[model samples]
Target: MLAQYLLGKFRALVRLLIQCVSPRQVKLETATYLRGSKTSELDDEDHNVVEWAFSGAYDGDKPILIDAENPARSLSKNKSLDLVTRLSGSFEPGSTVCLHLQNNILYPILVLAILATGCKWTGTNPACTRSELEDHLRVSRSKYIITSEDHEDMVFDVLCRMDEDIELILFSDVTVERPPSKDGKHPTLHDLLANSTFLPLESRYQRLSARTAATLMASSGTTGLPKMAIRAHGALVCESRSDELQDAHKPYKIRRLFCTPMFHAYSFPKMVINPLRQGQPTYYMQRFDDTFIQKLSLYSITDIITVPPILSRLVDQARGGDAKPLLQSLRTIICAGAPLTVKLRDEFIQLFSNPPQLIQEWGMTECGCISRAGDLDADMPTTVGRPVAGYLVKISQEERVEIPGGGFASELLVKGPQLMDCYLGDDSATASHVTSDGWYKTGDVGYLDARGRIFLVDRAKDIIKVNGWQVSAAELEKTVLQVPGVMDAAALSMGHSLDEHPYICVVRTDHGVSEKEIREVLRSQLSRYKGSRCELQFVDGLPRAASGKLLRRKLKAQLTHREK
Candidate 1:
């Protein structure tokens, strides 16, 4: 045992030395599959994720999580662990617990408690409509749901519609006091935590394995209805450590402002798991709004993980007046979920005298972050950088032929420790996406550069053929966004595949730009064949998922209904 322990430490030291001395360089053409520089097999032990999280290098007394709205309410590492132990007895082992609340101080602790009790966890957007909530509940097959008082009616209505006997638990704000529950059917979280017996940490079930499903996050569902993606404990554990190779050499203090929805996979591990493991302090905002700039200045936040739309909003706010003072404390902005446009990236950088580093990440709900552009490669803003440690990426044509570097755009296939175990209860769907050889089809179309950097073009299903040439809807939308007055845009095929033309739905500012001017700009910016047969429609807004992904299918369906 001692020799094995020393060997494991030696291996970790070697990996760190290699990463620090010379980062793994990607030799794109050396093999059919491109692997990251650092690699290791994760231990597939029956370790609970909560235990792994608490075993990090965090101070017991320092505040780890704070409620931005009510600064007084916070949790340190020790306090959080105690809360998790107390709440663990409230859940049944092996049952699924669903959270339907916005970002709050107790969100991460609640997730830990649920996992600690050997319960699988999932979350739905609190703003989801009845139908959407019904779909989520039905798919997750949750036995209990925890929601806030504001959304209790909606949850009850959805439960009634589904006719499922799922127990509902109201989540009370820790900062505010509320009367005890009058109905036995629904008890508030505060009540449960107070009344439930505290189970000794060692007395809890200890049968969890790496393959145990820890979370069931809903996919972005931009193409259709959302599907529950099953993420195993091992995958999430690997994902939480993804940045170690890049960040170990430069350990800096980070005070993060986490406003992104916690329900989405993009924010889940980053906000809940990483902060605890890294000993970083995070302020939780219920939602983002006009006061976002104020909150940044108020909290003196150093870093943020967000999407492109929020950055666009910041750029617009900067244009109104000087924003450097409010944003002066920000050191880094990690953008993911959707592709970041060059125009927006440049504009955002120009906001500060000393611009914070903007790192673009690429991944999906089925997998945690696949790649991230580090500070060293910040100049290449267009690319999503190379695959991070433990991930292998390859580009493949529809016929499963591997494409070499600098080839045309094809579907991106990835094999990684962070890949989802399966889509919950959907073997057919899982089989269709994961190949027999274990590559997970990403459904994204992009090519790797000579340096092994990934440049995403568009979704495979979103590509339209015009005049026998394939065109990317994302590329078209990016071009449209370059127009001065365009605030938002979505590009889609207007007709059948063989005879398709680009149709752009745009939301414009008060600048009053004409469709003719936009067409002229597109003609100058894009290929003649790609731009000539384009149609434009000005709308107030475009449909988008909670993650800021364009709902192209929804937009197409709306247009089809209008044409009918």
Candidate 2:
């Protein structure tokens, strides 16, 4: 009753405020309509943020539930400036906005938007063409773009390709190569920020629709075309509950290191955006380096968002005395992307003062974070953790059985608002992935136990059937990475032979581990049937994206070329 009463008061207050701001009397029903209806047979889970907003739950008057108090040396010299100044200027209501740049800078902007009284911050892919960029701008209905000096030309060029008048916020004054005549157009990012002024925009009871674009991010297009992933505010509200995935929210002022590309799911949701709701400072590496990670304690850093390979580098650092006790300051470390092996996870835990939690989260570009296993118990390194709060996941039976529990690990399907509304410009692809029932079929295979924890076995695409026996490529790579001097490994099957075993390629580190040593290690780990048929090839490093995800298909392409 108390919650209901407070919500009623909140609605009245916002109604009064909106009328006061607009000269003409605002449309009570048209301006903010909070209702519940559906055309689908099964739409019980649909949540509308706009409805919640009108009722006060999502009203703009709510202070950020996520706390931001980093006493530790987390905030960068520039991040402090970004946390306030940037949002105050860019998120003015009634004005359209667009943000383009690299992944490293968008983290802070996402944080600022949550505090911007219901402003929508649309994103564009850095690798997108002028055509795609312009199309997204027109469709999204953005008025301005917050860009950097590096992208000034591209943004202006993209603008020229569009019909709308565009505004910009540039951080640096940069120009291209000098010409003899020196008669080319050039402008600084600072030029716009200084001249642009933003007024106070406080519209109470503001909430985005459940289907409204929460924030825009693009997929890397490993399989096909790059597409925009639409996230609705209600999904964000659900994703915001991801904080509960951590056993207890530690109230600490610690510097968090961000090295992953924030545009994708690997880091943006799990590492950067989620942590900000806690109100801690996150330091950006703009670029990644092992040495930069090695010297983090010098900055009083306690947490880091990284992939396994980077952790492998840190483990290498621990083997030496260079980073030493200073590395001890690292309170917690998180890993995502590829699976972490038992050997690697154990080594990382031992190096920590008291085994920092190794939070392994699982998700994709289309769906934000779905489940997170806070840390791997020594017994269950292969098992990714439980589903985050407000999330439900199930695995389909590989074969049709009389009755199969969706809870069992099969093909992991997620049903949550945190999922993308569609793959930009590709309705067929979107429909193919998302079922009419609101369940998204994740290509990766995993099962949930009674505890609701998600354990991934392998990607369905990478699974190989050997005489009707199931074989996991990831299982092979995990064993290969354990060989003495072997730094990294990846596995893939090339062909279906008489017995159905395909060619497997192994990428190695510069640690001098040889083919013979790797083969011997696999022999010890695998059965004779699996081991005798294996082949090994040594290469420099695995082919991966900027975000550190391996592209086995690319590796196979490289191998095919060599054979040709």
Over 296-361, each residue of candidate 1 has an lDDT whose tens digit, in order, gives 999888789877768878878878667657886776788886667767776786676555667888
Which portions of model 1 miss their true places by more than 4 Å? 1-32, 41-46, 174-185, 220-224, 399-406, 462-564
Q: Give the Cα-based TM-score of candidate 2 against the true structure.
A: 0.59
Error of 1 at 546 (Å): 36
lDDT (tens digit, per residue) of candidate 2 on 310-357: 777778877776566667667667676656666776677666543455
TM-score of each: 0.75, 0.59
- Note the Cα lDDT for every prediction shown: 0.76, 0.55
Best by lDDT: 1
Q: Which parts of model 2 are misplaced by more than 4 Å? A: 1-98, 103-107, 110-145, 153-169, 173-197, 204-211, 220-223, 244-253, 270-276, 397-409, 461-564
- Clash number for candidate 1: 0
